[model samples]
Target: MNENDKQPDGSGGPGGNPWMKSLLVWVCILLGLALFVTVLGGPSATATGNTVPYSTFLDKVNEGTVKDVTISREQIAGTLSSGEKFRTVPIADPTLVPTLREKGVTIAAQPAEGGSIWVALLYQSLPLLLFLGIAFFVIRQMQKNSGSGAMGFGKSRAKMLTQKEGRVTFADVAGIDEAREELEEIVDFLKDPTKFARLGGKIPKGALLVGSPGTGKTLLARAIAGEAGVPFFTISGSDFVEMFVGVGASRVRDMFEQAKKSAPCIVFIDEIDAVGRHRGAGLGNGNDEREQTLNQLLVEMDGFDANEGIIIIAATNRPDVLDPALLRPGRFDRRVTVPLPDIEGRLKILEVHMKKVPVAPDVDARTIARGTPGMAGADLANLVNEAALMAARLGKRLVSMAQFELAKDRVIMGTEWKSLVMTDDEKRMTAYHEAGHAVVRVHTPASDPIHKATIIPRGGALGMVVSMPERDNYSYHRDKMFADLATVMGGRVAEELIFGHEKVSSGASGDIKQATKLARAMVTQWGMSEKLGMLMYEEQQGETFLGYSQTQRHNISNETALAIDSEIRALVDGGYDKAKQVLSDNIEHLHRVAKALLEFETLTGDEIKRLVAGEDIDRDAPGAAATTVPVSGTSIPKTRRPKGPFGSPAPQGA
Candidate 1:
């Protein structure tokens, strides 16, 4: 037997079936409910007044106090002159009725229609009718939801979208031209399947779209559907699996069967990793429904003949977890990758969004694209929306570069937190901290250009110094890494130099973490340490912290471990000293930038550059230092800054 074929936990071996426990519990509950309703129920409305002997009833009737009487087969009910109602057992005497008629009392004797027995029966049956009606309604709803009955869990739930359903064509998609071209071929085949079949070629049965989330997987599928102008069926991976076994398998069969009826159609399963994971790896003890569903999907995919005109496309971010059988040649003929857009691709995506909104003459989508790297199509769309919102809040006629800059900041960080009041000392410290980062970046030739600097408390940090490349950067040199480390450490060095080491705040905690991480990567991952040579001492997955190891067994000797630690400390210490020296020499320039920040509370990248260069601004001019307000962050904006060299404006303390 296969090693993985071992019985799952609680599969009813020697320990007994787990279902027996649940069945026993249900039985106990039913018994308790039955006892509660029968023994513990309260009194009824007809159970009032005490029973009297037939002789006493006859005496009361003779006294002429009895007003009316109702008689049944075995009982007699009557009302007195004082309007009190009473009931009593009837005696077996023919004289009873004649005696009542002889007196001035009115008497009634009837069948089931209006007798006391019939009234009691009607009241008793009403509650029963009400309970049965409710039960019937609940049962009908369950059948409607669960595929005709409890056993219909395997019914198909794929939604069919015609051309009018959010009709997205190839023109609506951007930032993935290569992927679009590949999908376009599929559309062509669908448009005219005979074109390829006549040449003795088979149409591709399936195309797999692999990418990170929000990178346009679903949009691409829709674009294909719109381009082909055929029925588009959409279903998620989770829709197939249910608590009952074989349901997912049934749904898979049903989904394909429905799609086949519409022959020239596209079936898209989004996030198929939910059901397509490797079989037999789950928390369940016995047969798993997900595996059954996956097996059914594989059979259906394989069952279809070539050029049958029913195409399947599945999307998943986790291609690693998918079973290899589903990815074989005949099943998935094409695999397309959709990654985050590069600079040019970002520009195209921005232009597409830009066309939908009103923009000023100064707005340049290409320039914005150059500033934004490592952003997906969805992220760009969100950026455009944020920019338009900012413009409208500012009451501007058109979307300006200024609004775009603020939107970018809001996206990268969080909404501005200007309402958080801070003391003068804290603000000064924040200014110096960011100035230190900016100064070190400017002096190091290998460092990225300083795009902006601010003392405003945005996101969780008290301040931030942003570094941007002229264009999208793919590779980094060793010297650049060293420079980056120095830049990260400079803030702490600045605080220690100015406020004394003991007075330095814990705000540098994040900075120390970043610097330590970079230094350790240099020694262990990058092989920059001469003592370590080109060999890797750590495990396959590197650590998140410097000098933190993940291996179960020690790969290196005790002496080598000590040496690795020594190298990491040496790298960080060396970078720290480099930063100190730069700050000491550029103390005057740092003060100028801080002074400007203290007065204006914020400065754009252009303004920072100008300030650092010792350029004099018209301090008294109209709107020379006007700050834009944060319109909707609960805190009214005291000032707004313009966009900087990076796609958005440089943020000061806005």
Candidate 2:
């Protein structure tokens, strides 16, 4: 046999050769037995015309020479008695006429065949028996390897990554500018341990990446491994637990042992809060297995020093529910925050993802970024991919701005329900409703500059008005908050004024929720309510410092909550009254603006200003200089705010 046929352990093959080695002894024994049977009672060599006497056959058989012979039992009685005849072949000598029967035996003449039946039975049965023995041995071995076929109950769920599948580097991630910067230092530390060790500085034993789901925490961890050029072992916190007791602890030990052997490596456990949740907080059965896993993890992190060059990285979106012990200073010494990207960050993300896609020149990444205000990296990537698909469907060579727009609408809104036909009156009503928001926001001084207004139904909304900040604002002044509230209520107010209080749909449900939440927070959480005093009722916890303390406030009485509710409703109602009056006073301008909005579904801030300027309102006044709110991290000059017809400062910021 070739080398390929050899067993893996290099044994001489199977044990079947041992049975073959004893073949000679069995063959010799079979031959000797045949000879003895022939000598004890033999037949005559010749085919007898007359039957031989039994006594004569016995005397001739003592010579042990029988060639071929047949005899009748009555003819040969003394040596052997045979009813059935047999052909007697040569035993030893041919010349000797063996007796037909001897020792009270007789034979009868018969036509006969010549072989031993016992030998044939032995030949067939021996091989069959050997094959059965081999099959049984194979089955016993398989049972042992399968752990008695019990592999199904408690299998580990961790995924394995080897050198063949190349690792992810920081470059692959996009849009998370702040998060990437924080993790870059980690890569450096893992690569050159001596750089810190020589100066008595120790690398952090663990780092926790906390963010909303799909914010690329896990991706960043993999980048660290790839950038460091080290082996990476990944497992979920849930993987450590099994059905049996002590299994979780054993898995923890095994995982760490693997990391140590492949020193200068990373161990990434995603969704660690699964096993690292607050102990004793679960319902019945109370997560004892999880707690054991957590304890073991604590020991492993504690046992490893920075010199070992084995770093642990973990990620969780729900940082609020994690155990304080797990996030302590000694364990996860560094905490990386991955927040939602802003407009400029989104533009950068789009640029990175757009490299592979064929896009038209007019398809602006900056504009797309501004449109997706709260999108994460994953969402932006999906938008790019969606835009490409839209272009392909239209048989376009490249993704155009129009395709991007369609893709954006599809992502934000469900795909267009073109079959859901609307009457002309309904479409006009939507136009006027959206126009009301644009008109009021353009005229109102406190609202942010209007970016676009559209009557086209999107994301289940009959219409939409997109207002963008001239610059980013970190803090919202009370006047700005009240202004935003008015703008939100403007669409509904406009519908009421034009449609004369007909049935209103729940199109403004999301806007109402957002407005109400802000209004309530201004009263209870932010202490913006004058009547409620400046005591913060709702706690605001920093995303990074979560789980380190009990961040709840002392509960107030139900009477106070009622009072708070009343104050919030009163504040929103007052804002709505102000917005309605503003729209009503400019009824003529409102009509002209709404008509323009219906004509062209979108208008820029400048276009709206020109349209509303229709030579009717004041344009200039003393102390009308636009107030500039400092939006941090921005150097771009703010666009001037809209002014009244007489140059009077618009009622902006109230």
Candidate 3:
């Protein structure tokens, strides 16, 4: 056992030992017997007599000092006239009885009690037995608490899931269709192994579910089990390891032993990275207990002893950190990537979740899916739940489009900070800052369409200008990146233009930081800087030990580092200049939109465009009129407002 196995009191838990419980039962029985003897036989033995010689007994009787006598086969006991007690050995003389009668003493006779010697011996050993029982019980309790008793430390903690009623099948899962399809084959293979076996193919020993967190990797694994209708054993990677050196390895062996017995089973290990990290990658000798566990796991998965009917399905977001041995062909035969849902996938996910709620007709899943570009299935489910909650809070029978819109805002931007009170000047500044972003996005050709602009505080932002992409965008071009850079700079430029540079508040600090990160990524990561010539300079850092870097290896020279910094600054300045130019060119539009935002606190893209066109917005109108807003010496084509829940276009950019 290691340091982790040590308890504060250094005793094992009660349940740690099987025999300790029996000892406790014996202790209770002994105590009960002791009490019984003390209570039932105590009265008869209460009169204890002092031992005296036969001559003395005779003298006492002659003096008339003895009150009565009780005689057994081997002894005589009598009480003196003074109420004192005495006992003496009987003589072989027959005149003893008659002498007692002449003295006018009352006499009684009784048989001797049996087994008194054995009873005394039991009483002598009871204390020692009780002491040993208590010691064993304490040791058992300590071992149970530390979860490292002699017999229990090596047991596997994998829980065999018996999901009967709420079992999830492949049909219930949506989004990441590719990952689902890959897993469906595993389900098919499990259901009929002969189908694959006849083709000279063994069931893939394992399938690795690689995805970002909440991308439905674990759900997919369960769906495979449900569809196959096989036994499912689930355990976390951390469950196999303990502070003890060999406990994890022992557990791995035990888990495999169990899995082998329940053949044709699926063992789902969530977050395998906890135990499957790259061996010898961290500091120290790298032969820790976790590594030992991983080694055992590797051997169990694809060692000399083949585990025939067992399929291992493990999920982890950090696949890059996993040991190569664990990911070898014989171990994890297939690596299934469960990427974030695309537009269609998101719509299907929304539809699946919306089925559980009472959504009004106004709810449009496509528009919502479009609005949420990078959200996973879990996120969409949460969005639907939030919408339903908001509708319930508003005393609505059904979740409407308005609730969904609010929920989307809540999910993406965060819960609205209604309690954050802002002064008039601060509110006006925020309105203009958001308006600046909107105007610049609308005018920039490569920029995504503006979805909504608001001066209401949400999360850490006093206001935000949201833009929605026309469709799901997988990659960004240089022009679009430039446009985004410019859009982010709009807030800071607006603050400077409205209030003097010296008077600008720290409200633009987030915007500045965002812009800086984007610029740096473009320069060093995206190879967008011409001066840097498509060369990658930034070193990618992965997981480290105890919050310390294993190595600080700078591959670039000082001159190269300076060049990268200069390129980043140039990109940011260029974006700032572009935003200033766009905002300056469309100054009138910027003011009108900002004033409208101040009045409404929030405005959709169509409303902002209408405001730019100097049109009065009819708040009561369900679908407002279309209008062409002027932008940078060009007129934006007239586009009608999308009907249904999302009043604005889908959000595209963050």
Candidate that would win on TM-score: 3
Candidate 2 per-residue C-alpha lDDT over 131-202 given as tens digits, one digit per residue, 9 for 90 to 100 = 665666556555443234434223334444665576678788877878888888878887777888899988
| Candidate 3 lDDT over residue span 1-654, tens digit each | 766775554434433444555566776877797986675445346557898999999889888888899987667888998999898888787987898899899999866667555666667877886787678777876677545566687888898988777799888899888888888888888888999989898878999999877899988988888889989999999998799899899988888888888989999999999999999999878858999999999999999999999999999988989999998999999999999888899999999999999999877899888878768888889999999998999899999887788888777666667677889999888878888888888888887877677777765567777666788765668888788778878877887888878877777665665677667767776678888888766644654577332323358888998998898899889989999999888889888988887877878888887878778777756644222121111011112111111112221222
TM-scores of all predicted structures: 0.78, 0.69, 0.80
Decreasing lDDT order of the candidates: 3, 1, 2
Please provide, for model 1 over 213-258, each residue's C-alpha lDDT reduced to its tens digit, 9 standing for 90 to 100: 8889999999999999998999999999888889899999889889
Assess the local accuracy of residue 382 in candidate 2 as a C-alpha lDDT between 0 and 100.
88
| Model 2, runs deviating above 4 Å | 1-167, 304-307, 502-506, 540-554, 596-610, 613-654
Give RMSD to native, each candidate.
11.6, 13.2, 9.1
TM-score of 2: 0.69
Question: How far is 604's C-alpha from truth in model 2 (Å)?
Answer: 5.8
Error of 2 at 357 (Å): 1.4
